[model samples]
Target: MTTVLIVASNVPAQPAVLTEALERFKGRGARVAVACFFDAAELEIDPALAEIRSFAVPKEQIDKRLRTALGRAPANRKIWLHAQRSGWLMKWARTADLLVAIDPRSVHTVWEMAQRNVAASACYGLVPALRALDAGVSAPVTTRLERQVSATAARGVRGARRAAISSAKTTLRKATGQKVMGTPAGAWLWTRAVSAPKIPDRYRSKLAARVHDSAVRAGRHAEAARAATAAVSRITNAATRAELLTKAAQSELAVGRVPERLHDAISAQLTLADSLLRKDRKRAATALSNAWSLASNRVLHFDRLSSPLVDDPAGYLAPFRASEAARLLSAPRGRSVPAAPVPSGRPLRILLATLINDNFLHEIRQRYEAMPNVEVRFLDLDDDPARRSLARSGSSVIEHKLAGHTPYGEKIEEWLRPHLDWADTVFIDWCQATAALFTMPDPGDTRIVIRLHSFEAFNFWPHLVDFSRVDDVVFVSDHLRDLSTAVLPQLLGAEAPRLWVIDNAMDLQRYARPKPAQARFNLGMVGVGSVAKDPRWTIEVLRHLRRQDERYQLLLIGSDLNAKTSVAAKQYADLLKRDLAELEPSGAVQRRGQTDDVPAALAEVGVIVSSSVRESFHCGLVEGAASGAVPVVRDWPYFAGGAHGARTLFPADWVVDSPAQAAERILAATATEEDWRRSGQAAAEHTLKTWDWTVTQTAFDRLFLTD
Candidate 1:
């Protein structure tokens, strides 16, 4: 009997595809074993057909520091690193007659398996596997021991060569990773290597990025910046220079430090954009789009505690404003036809769209779906794998906008034009890629309304969005509106859309569950997914409260922070893990990881804390408040002292400046069960009356209902 091992990076979207393939294999007298990166339990199959195993490496098992360090490696390499450790996979791979990769992500695993099991036929996808089986090769006479010996010999030779190369690289990398990079000798050596004659542009850029990452890690920012400039200067092509510079900037930003050459990278792209504008408009738009992408990277702005763009919007984006190509990109590409009037004859067709975050859209969708006068369709841009790629970058859309043609444009037209024709209004939830893609082609009488929450104002996405094509721009808060308009010049222009500050739709009624008297001393925080959430600040508050009364314990709800998102996130998570280690063991903090029933969880808490450094809207805090949890909100620093801030958004009593102040507020409010209940009841009433879906749905109706 023929033996087959099929490795899947993820569960197949259609399991029947795999099941059918398995049946065909079984009919051919093949015994199939399926190894997947996901859980075996999640995939239901006929037990007699195939043996299944999971090779999923739990997030907690992977060393985050190592993962962060390998951030620049190819996706395949990342997958290989995790899967290679599974002994079951090794044994199955060695014994199989044929190895199949169910998806692209599993191809590398199969490739590696092919190297070890030289006798096995490795192929990707079911069709390829079937073809390989049809075009059968003679079975190898080599025994398992002989194959292992041959594989070992091959690996040994390759290993020797790799080790020599690795040794040299390690020596160089270590030097850069230390304070040595700051020294004249280290700088001289790097300068020589980067500027070495006959070195290919690709090699030079690779060397520069490596050295840059190392230097940045070592805190030698100036040296890293110098190395990047010197390396890019050696590369003659403008595109190559811009690409290298952008990578360098991204590398720095990933680690939570703003590169000194970030402005230089943006300037390089602007120069390239201008050069391409006269010769090739599409390439120019792409260059400008890339510049905008770099300038607005979340790592540089929103994901961090501070943003240069937020500090001085006009100043930070001044380079783009000065560039002709950039100006062309942002220039009004007005709609071919005015937005169609909301038909009195039929229900108003509205499409609600967002990339990934749909937390705030639940209520809007429900309200509109329930409305007799409205017809709603929800489209998550990230839902479709094909559209997700298009929504990832603005270059393709910009190319289409400038040249009037692109594959992305055609695909978008084919995919979205149907929805555009059906809907009288498209309410895109974020001023990001989804907004940019939907607005790439003229709306043709379909009103485009995009909501800017918080992060988009700090990123390049809003710049890509055609404000002129949009009928209305919505903001969750006045502060977000002010910040967005200040950053995006098009929003300030005459053709700018009607700006509206509409609070996010939320159902607060479910959060009104009664709490026990002991809940008065229980503090809670709902989300801690980002560094901007500043969970450490919440910990400090808990620490302060614990000094007064150890009965005050923190209930941390929601998923743990994702350390893999960025270097900053990793560092923050490390700190949080350390804090949790101390508090959790002592029973001072309870980490009730992600749960579907948030309202039920909130019932255990008396106080809710919003410890974010920046927030357009603290939804978690609001939800908690609506759950009869007294809110102690840190005056969100991004807009704290601005014209509008958390202080203005919430009641003056609800907002505080520091952990000490937050702790003080919590203590005072929860001094007695009566006081705690009263405080929570008042806060709940305020959120329900002001920000709840019942109150906000009318504003949404007006936004769509208006001509």
Candidate 2:
């Protein structure tokens, strides 16, 4: 068998690339041996490749002399020294017909081996080695004395060139080292050099980053910021300027510090996006998307107790409003024809569409499917990989808008035009990617309706939607409608789609189960998986109640907060862990986790609390009320003191402004067994009469059946 040996100084950056090369080599009847300087466990090799063998250099097995030599050698030369002492690798190298270096650090080791194993074909990189194999190995030809002398001269010249380049790199490193950057004069000198005229944009950006990093490491953050800003100001290339500033901002955010030039960085990206819109739409989309990501980072918004978007919506969004590219995204594309009237003779064809999230559609779907005069069809873009990709390609949507027409736009038309032709109306569940995609192509005479839930109002998806193509916009509550209109503003224009506030459809009757007497002091909360839910606020309320009466305990439902979402989320989760650790072992806080049998779970809860920072209409709290639990709703800070909010959505007595107020309400409502039961019964009756599916379906009927 033809033996092939591959050497890597470190773990392969792209294992799939190495795997494909190995498989190709095996197909050619080659027995491969891979030698890695690092541990073998870091790379997961397929056991099925039994013909291939791998060896990891065991540091413990090396003698003191070799280990000391390895520690002192440069990174690349150390690989060569390690291989020279590895008996198993040396044995394979002697017999191998082909030698390959998978990475740059291994190239030097392979080159040294090639001088000893002159008969074997050697190459740097997998592709060059593969090409060498394809050319077939041959015996070395004899050379004259003159040719040998000439080859020696060429090697000496190349070695000298490499030495010169290494010396230059050493000098550059010293010039911008942390010790030098610690001084004000050194920092100022390097900053000026980076911003000097005629420096290549690529080189200037890289140098500016190095200087900034060195200054920051030397405890000169202000100097680092000034250096980056100065360098960016000199960069005439829009893409390069935006990229450098964005990197600076991201580096700050990664270290848990907000960037001083955060707004400037966003503005640079938006300017780049606008400049590239017509010439290169894809690039423009990328720049715009990056701008949005930086602006809406969790550190700036959700992870904190307050958000700039909430505290100062107009001021925070001023950058987006000023961007021409953002304007193009929201630019109205009016429909060619108004929606056709509901079918007179045949059934009205209704299409319900969403991407993966079908939690809110079960009731509406069942209601329409059971009706004889309606033909219902459901489209989940996620069901098909190709369709899902098209639906979620926000960049492609932006590109199509800028270029006026693109293959992506045509693909959207091809995929959705047939559904539009078949359906008299399409109801898109969330104002997200699905909504934006549906509006990409004109719906012809098919009416388009989209629902804006609480979260979508804070996301970029709503901004991508073209409201002129939609006939109606639905909100679950009046507070949500008010917030949505304030955020979009276009919704209030004369040409904007008709807005409606329809309560969410829910079957609340199933929750009317008998509660045991002990349940009167147990509090319940559902859906604590997001930062907005603010489970910590609920914990605070629990603390207040327990101070007065030790009988009160909290039953936390739903999944735990996902800390992996963002740094702010992780900080919040850490604080929550500390709270749980204090109360959980004492049996004061009980975690029931997630359960499908929510109504049964409600049987143990006497009071339901909504301690959210914001909510459109809290479905879980209402469901608890239907189960004969007194409701205590926080004013939902996102809309408090507005035209409509939690106070207007629920009864005035049920809403509270603070944890102490919530505790007082809970105590008064549950003063005695008779009073508690009577209060829960009253709340249950109010919720059942107002928000149940039986009561809300009529409004849906009027929406779909009449119009």
Candidate 3:
């Protein structure tokens, strides 16, 4: 068997690409294994594949150590530390038949690994991996010192520019913090304490902590805050007040102390979050967490001001409730003034459309688009800047998320109705604002269908869906349906319309690849960027495997954690990065970053793991399974206990909890190379037979094509 080992960075797109290759290779008895750092549990794999395990290297632990070291070290030494660690990473190199990198950031590590693993052919992207495999030879490509110098210089230029910008931000934040919190009394203590030279670095943080506490205890919060601000302000530090405030808030909350100037804390953190979000939106999630912690503070609810939710639900929630963010979370509905028959003109020009994610509508659109029976117009909410409303919530752009959709929502209805009036049916994707807006009123004679994905259940959009106008609600999974029903009982109310669970339209025919000789050893996961897509758990599995044998390593795809965006995000990112750092250099895990192709990445991944806490339908895992990667599922804690979840989505043998169980399964499957190859072929067949778009599109056709 020509064995293929995919070194992925846990990108979400990996599964789809892999599934395609598995189909082609399986009939030929090729072996495949996917080794990655992120979780792929959400991807419900076909049971035919061998059991999959995660080769995760907990980068968070090393990152934490690095952060601790950085916190203690002089700023000049950070780069030196990173360079010194390259020597520490050589042990994890893989001698796979093929190596594919899923992201750009991971290219460096992959390049290093390829240098030592001369038997392995390395390439970026699933397509590239496939090409390398087709070449059937491992050619050693070397990077000379001159080339490294050029690359380093280019990177230095980029880093220099980034550092300059970061310095400016830091300076501004420190200045703001000093102005906002500095007090003469507290300043006296800080000035003397900070100026003391040659004090042990270890004691520095503790000393600073003592001074801060003294100021707080003395009822000089502003003074204490200002002191820290002053210390940080002048150094062109990127860490700003919002970051400080969050740290302060976290400490206070942990000890159960609320900031005296709660409003100041909230606003300061929010403003900082806004600024950070302007640059990097992902980090804004933490800003929301921080804001929530503050707003949900007892003082705001009971200690002082009356909650807007309690006082005036309509007016208070106006900012949030009226936002496109909230609207996207709801079901679709039409107005009370509805009953109109299709006019006796041209054939019903049904307009089946959605905002952007048309996963469910692909087949339905094609069917209707080809229906000689209708006229069609598909609108992506993101296509028009005016219509897109979901920005990072509460980042300075919150006002935008709130204010941005009102007119646009109306314009949508205006632009859409004419087509609705012209045609008969109008299908919208996601129960998001697109659905809400389309159903804002009666669509003269048009029938409307709105699909509900998993996330919209946790949010507010389902509450806004005017059931009065909606004709159908489509769901991808049953657990989502059950949870959504409980979350929004309005569906059980008089206005509720028809709701159905339709599988997503995925063309999974490509899986069915031959396994390589060492296909039994690798474990893979797809997607690792979000908190929801937890990669840490996968690390635990790898840890388990190393205890048995150190042959396993994880591969992560996607951007590294960016905590600089918000305190909450930073905290989480910091933790995750720490986990990655420890695991990465040890060769226990590899993070590749984001990529477009998956089949090539899957070429090397023998096993696939899903590690999400929650999900709608983890298309990634299913795609991985289709690619013939042994699918190991986490049972999906978010949707596990529900009626429809990972259990119902995939065969029972595939699901498990904890990394130990995952390791046990991987060990058993890899016990023999022959055992591994058969399992992979079976999985590829299952994915191709079950989830291919040809099969799923039928469900779509039934949902949209039916009267």
Candidate 4:
């Protein structure tokens, strides 16, 4: 019989692995013990494996001062102090035949003990430790000495680099710290030296570095950092101080670049991230984002990557898999207990939820509000003034989702936890915010249903959801489901929720209006802002039509591409503008900025064109077809080989693989206005019969009703 002990940090998914290891060992007459400094939440052990005892000293008992002091101490000293004080660890360690350090932070303490106890085997992970305990191969003593020597050499190298950096930083700090510029006389002297016209870029950077070094020597980090930052800025050569500092910080963050002295890189990045965030600049936000990537730990050198927490909530956060934070984020569903034999039904309760999009909810709410058994409520997280202010400013954004878990995640959970407790079923709309908030797992026994549309699949939100609590995942199309499952591995976990495919709810009855005869030769496109839309191809098809007959005109709808979002977007907008410039004045094309009257917009489009590379459903094109426009869809390259997308959404003849093919279809349809009207009439009937809200509402009903 063997006993194994596992010591770990409060990482995401610890309990599941712990339980599995115990189960594997139980067959071999092995007993396991577990320990943690932080709460475990994301996973739980089976009752059979619950015999494993894990120890923890209350976080409140630890002193912040001591923690800080320990952080600055020598490596061996830190381990010695920690082991001596953490008696729970020592007590548990004494009984174990095999000891495992579940995280890097816990590895040192285990190593320290292994030096004193030669009979026990030590491993880095649960799997390795369990294997060692089962096989019964104990660690050798002289081999331990060799391991210690190698570890000491590695630590020495890191210490030397950190020492060199500390020395240089001190020198720079003193040079820049002086209040020299604060005095008029000193400012004048500094101004003359910096403003020297003939000083080449190389010389200027050298002088700036010297000045910065002087500021550091004077004991002023603020002044030194400032002088260094300023000198780097003033040197005209791109390779000067300013460029060098940024490069130095970035290069130092490269994998294994400066693990020991990496604090400065993180500090520089945060300084820049905060500055950009304060000023509300998007470009600076991107630069800071790159800085964060380089600063991340590749494997185990630094802190474990947050990507795992965001990507695979259950598996990655296993250590914290069953804590209040983890449970609140990932609620485990209990087996059905047959609803306590209802003698008499009082009323039905319905919870209405839309994360950021409240589009179809108005009608859904209206229907439920009139029912005696149903209660309707609406919550918009973005409506909060603080969040709104952040979105409007778009500054210092915390690199999308890494920033997601902080202010946004906490505020959302606080607001939604109560609602989740009471509602029998919560319908979370739009997989972005809705899925993310509900996935935090405080279900309070309420059933969770998340609806996935097109864009959410491409983003980081779905990855943030804790699937343990989600009762049902609703996808708009099979193609979206396929893509989402392919990109996210956690969705396939044992606890993953059942999935349902339902079309988007659109009131197509409004688009059952009449169309003008001239629309027969017109090609209309709605929402051309994204590069994924590939509107340029639509223009090619239009040009081909015009060569055969000038009667064909294209109508473009929606606001132009936004320059604020990205440089690539701005560049694409420029090229689009040039294309529009030639076509608009020639009466070959028309631009309608934005309008609330969609039925009216569809009226002028006899031939609706969907030119996107991918789409979950393409609601606009369907609406246009219902308005009597013949639909022509690009094969939708993103899902061309997948199970379903634009091709399956529309009729077989309606989908075209290329611009040339689209032009061919247009030419045949508009051979005569009479012929075009007949073809469009058939398309309108098929669209209304197949994809209208009347039909889609049934699909949604079945999904919500099925357990």
Q: Estimate every model's Cα lDDT from 0 to 1.
A: 0.83, 0.86, 0.60, 0.63
Model 1: CA > 4 A from native: 1-184, 188-211, 229-240, 280-286, 381-389
What does candidate 4's lDDT look like per residue over 1-707, in tens digits?
A: 67677766555354556666667877777666666555433346564653433334455765896686566777645544555576766776766778788777778778766654546788898778766766675556787577667656766776699799879867644443446644545444543464466777776665554554343333333443554555555665432432445443333232212332234433444445444553543434454444434433332111211123224434432322222221222233333321221113554455777645787566566655776655666767677766543332212233333333456546556767787756767788877655665655356557777777766654434544667667778887888887777655556677677788877777788887777778787799988766667677899899888998998999988876554443445555677788889999988989887889978888888899998877778888888888888889998877776677777767899999988999999888878888788888898888877887778777765654445
User: lDDT winner among the candidates?
Assistant: 2
**Structural similarity to truth (TM-score) of each candidate:** 0.73, 0.79, 0.53, 0.53
Q: Which tens-of-lDDT digit does each residue in 1-707 have in candidate 2? A: 77788998778879888889878877877788888777766778775542333445567877898887777679888888778776888887877888899889999888777665666778888888778777876454653344445545666786698689768867888889889999989988997888889889998998888787777668778988988988998888888888888887876665545677888889999999988877877889899989887887776666656666776667777888999998888899888999998989999999999999999999999999998999999999899886678877777887777777899989889998999999998999999999988898889999998998987877788888899999999999998888788778778889999999999999999999999999999999988887888988888999999999989999988898878876667878999999999999988899999999999999999999999988888999999999999999988887888889998999999999999999999999999999999999999999999999999999999889877
Higher TM-score: candidate 2 or 3? 2
Name model 3 segments beyond 4 Å from true: 1-348, 356-364, 385-413, 561-565
RMSD, each candidate, Å?
Answer: 9.4, 7.1, 24.0, 23.3
lDDT of 3 at 305: 15
lDDT of 4: 0.63
Per-residue lDDT value at 124 in model 1: 84
Model 3: ten consecutive residues of lowest lDDT: 299-308
| Worst-scoring 10-residue span by lDDT in model 4 | 299-308
TM accuracy, model 4: 0.53
Candidate 3 matches the true fold with a TM-score of 0.53
Ranked candidates (TM-score, high to low): 2, 1, 4, 3
Whose TM-score is greatest here? 2
